[model samples]
Target: MTFLQALWHYPFLQIVMLAGLASAVASGVVGPLVVSRRLAFMAGGIAHSVLGGLGIAHWLGAPPLLGALLAAVASALLIAFASLRIRENEDMLIGALWAVGMAVGIIALAQAPGYSVNLMSYLLGSLLMATRDQVMLMLGLNALMLGLLWLSYRPLAATLFDPEFAALRGVPTGLLYACFLIVVALAVVVLVHTVGLVMVMALVTLPAATARLGTARLPAMMLAACGAALLAVSVGLATAYAGDLPAGATIVLCAALLYLAGLLIRHLMERRRRRSA
Candidate 1:
């Protein structure tokens, strides 16, 4: 009842709830495509790579969010170019970018004079610190991603699942791939605040991973992931509030538990099917 009252009474809490749900939707939709295309590591690289931009921003006394956006987009484009076109030691290149970016961020932080802001907040995240402006920004970004995905669903699905066939069918695979990377970069920016840079990849990947265990089709997988993400975010938010826990870590842990449960259920179902056969 106290929880219900707090939600019912507070406007800021409502905004936080809205933000959490919106973030989940963004992750749910993007995660499967990422996992399907085996770009999970690349996404992780992008996530960590943003820290370099943030550190640079702090050192220069500029807005870190803007810096993060530019840095992440740059990293995403570079990886997209190397992996898609060069096709030589692609993973190694991304790995190098990841390490270098993180190192740059740490160095920037260490050198910054009289830095008072807690880096933990950027790394672990706290939903209670969410502002109305940030929530609105996430809502806008989510709408943009969904709209773009809807407009290009056919070609995008083709590019995701079967790029060779898509190209053969006149899908302009190269252009679509670049556009997809742009969308991914934007999504990462929106998600970083929700789960922080360190744990953001888990939020992006876990729900979709659990959904993948049940469905093979892209559309079905996305819907299942949305459901899983919503439940995790809602439960985690409530649990964190009651226990005075870290919101970002709590949400991610909840999602991880769901993935494990999904894996267990999938294993059992497979065994049952084999026995019936």
Candidate 2:
């Protein structure tokens, strides 16, 4: 069957596509700020930390996503506090949190009955298993993310670019910084279902990084990133379905290829410009 035929005949593919697209847009929305503020490592830390919450939640027979959210938020706040006030090596603190969170999650999952059934999906993503409820949740969360960014664009941008200047101008830099980390945490969760916890970092950062090569404006970069993510998700999903490959890995690989291609194009363009000069 052709790709279009498969998409038309299989309802799950439709759901998967919707979920991937929603998650892609969410990543695009927060990605620029994450890149600008150099929070990719922090984002990765939060993404890894979520597994602990998921495992514990499963053990407790609660909603796993809720557990992931709690873990992500708690880690984000802790990272923020330590970075702002602890006078310690920030990477060490984040690394410690990352390791501890993963250890706790693994221990929790070990005790949970039937943990193996869905473990792969949580770790590596299961886009082919996307359900309507998940797609709905992603859409709702994506909308909320866009709303929050819209409301706080100016102060958030100012705080991200220059915290000291923003603080001097009464922009509540510390509060905004903390709040932004929370936003990043939320974004990571939104992406977990699309790229899984293991590959969330790539999807979250690659689109924005690729967009950065072509534009410096935040708005333009966001639009370009969204477009790039959408293309990657679409192409990857189609390719995965056609080839019977792992959807999350395929999507991430496609995004990574796009980034590399963008880098090559940028380098060539720069060299040409230099030669002309």
Q: Best-fitting candidate, measured by lDDT? A: 2
lDDT of 2 by residue, 1-277 (tens): 9877988998987888899899789888888888867778888889889999988999999877789889999998998888888766779988887898888888898898863646778889878887898788778777777887888889989988888899899898778888888888888888987888889989989999999999999999999999889989998998998899999999999999999999999999999999999
lDDT of 2 at 257: 95
What value of lDDT does candidate 2 attain over all alpha carbons?
0.87
Any runs in candidate 1 off by more than 4 Å, and if so which? 113-115, 270-277
Best by TM-score: 2
Error of 1 at 257 (Å): 1.1
In candidate 1, what are the lDDT values of residues 47-146, reduced to their tens digit? 8888889888888888777777788889878877886788757679778878988899878877877646678877787577888888887888888888
Model 1 backbone overlap count? 0
Relative to the true structure, how large is the alpha-carbon lDDT of every model? Answer: 0.85, 0.87
- True-structure RMSD for candidate 2: 1.6
